[model samples]
Target: FWESLLMQLLLFRESLLIHLLLFRESLLIKLLLFWESLLMQLLLFRESLLIHLLLFRESLLIQILLFRENLLMQLLFFRESLLTQLLLFRESLLTQLLLFRESLLIQLLLFRESLLIQLLLFWESLLIQLLLFRE
Candidate 1:
């Protein structure tokens, strides 16, 4: 009976060591898998950040193109309006010049008619005086 009890105690000690070793191996594996998952999450976050930066660059390019187009359109409109104003001013100047020319011509014609009437009256008076002296 003493030898049997000693053998049973030895077997129980061997089983407990085996159970402890298995539990330690399982815990190590759990820690390794957790670290691997954390590393994968960090890589995924970096990739997402890179994608967002690329998208932001593309949007910046689009905004620059739109601004350039708008600036070009504004320049074109300004040029057209400037040309229109110039043409209108030229037309007004020409009309004013023509009106001034017409007014000067009318004054010259009226002055010429008055000078002719004065010359005719002077000739008639001279003829009447000469006829009275002959009588």
Candidate 2:
């Protein structure tokens, strides 16, 4: 009976050592899986950041193009407005010159009429003096 009990105790110790080794191996596998999951998460984050950077660059380019177009449109509008003002100024100057010409023509006509009336009065007075001398 003593020999049998000793054999059973040795067998039990060996089985317990094997169980401990399996538990340690399972723990190592769990740790390795957790590290792999963390690496995958990091890679995904890096990819997301790169995508965002590309999008921002594209947006910046579009904004620059829009601003240039707006500036060109404004310049065109200014040119058109300046041309219109110049035309209006030219028309106004022409109108003033025409009015001055009309006034000069009217003044010349009035002077001519006054000279004709003075000549007629001189002829009539001369005729009356002749008739009195004959009588």
Candidate 3:
């Protein structure tokens, strides 16, 4: 009976050692899988950041092009407005010159009519005097 008890105790100790070794190996495997998952997450995050930066750069370029186009349109409008103003000014000047010419012509005609009336009066008086002296 004493020998049988000793053998039983030795077998239990060996089985306990085997169980501990298997538990340690399982824990190590769990840690390795966690590390791999963390590395994959980091790589995915870096890739997303790079994609976002490229999209932002493209959007900025488009905005700059639109701003330049708007500026060019404004300049074209300004040039057209300036040309219109110049044309209006030229027309006004021409109209003023034509009015002045008409007024000057009217003044000269009035003066010529007065001179002709005086000449006609002088001729009539000379004829009457000559007729009386002959009678």
Candidate 4:
């Protein structure tokens, strides 16, 4: 009877060890599956974010173009008004005055155009920095 009890105890210990090892393996498999799912979700979220960023950039580009067009139109209208002034003063004794005003206006407009170009360049650099930061 003593020998039989010792054999049963040994068998029980072996079965318990097997069960523990199998349980550990199953847990590891579940953990791996969970990690894979999380990684896939992260990738999908990143792709969606990229799409949104592209759309936002497109809209901003369009708005900047429209702003540039509006500025150009305003500049053209100003030029036309200057021409009208020139024609009106052409036959008068104020030729020197007219020339001085015309030259000054042209210089001012050129300065404004340079300033706008600088501002646009600033915006473009800022946008590129933002995009780089995201990556």
Best by lDDT: 4
Each prediction's TM-score versus the true structure: 0.64, 0.54, 0.55, 0.57
TM-score computed on alpha carbons, candidate 2: 0.54
Which one wins on TM-score?
A: 1
Per model, state how many residue pairs clash. Answer: 0, 0, 0, 0
For model 3, what is the alpha-carbon lDDT of residue 127?
82
- Sorting all predicted structures by lDDT, with the top scorer first, yields 4, 1, 2, 3
| Residue range with the least summed lDDT across 10 consecutive positions in model 4 | 86-95
Candidate 2 per-residue lDDT, tens place, 1-135, comes to 988898888888888888888888998999999999999999999999999999999999999999999999999999999999999999999899899888888888887777777777777777888888789
lDDT of 1 by residue, 1-135 (tens): 888998888888888889998999999999999999999999999999999999999999999999999999999999999999999999999999999899988888888888888887888888888898788
- Compute the lDDT of residue 104 as modeled in candidate 1: 88
Candidate 1 stretches with Cα past 4 Å from truth are: 1-15, 109-113, 116-135
Candidate 3 steric clashes: 0
> What digit string (tens of lDDT, one per residue) describes model 3 on residues 1-135?
978888888788777877888888888888889998998999899999999999999999999999999999999999999999999999999999999988888888877787777777777787888898789
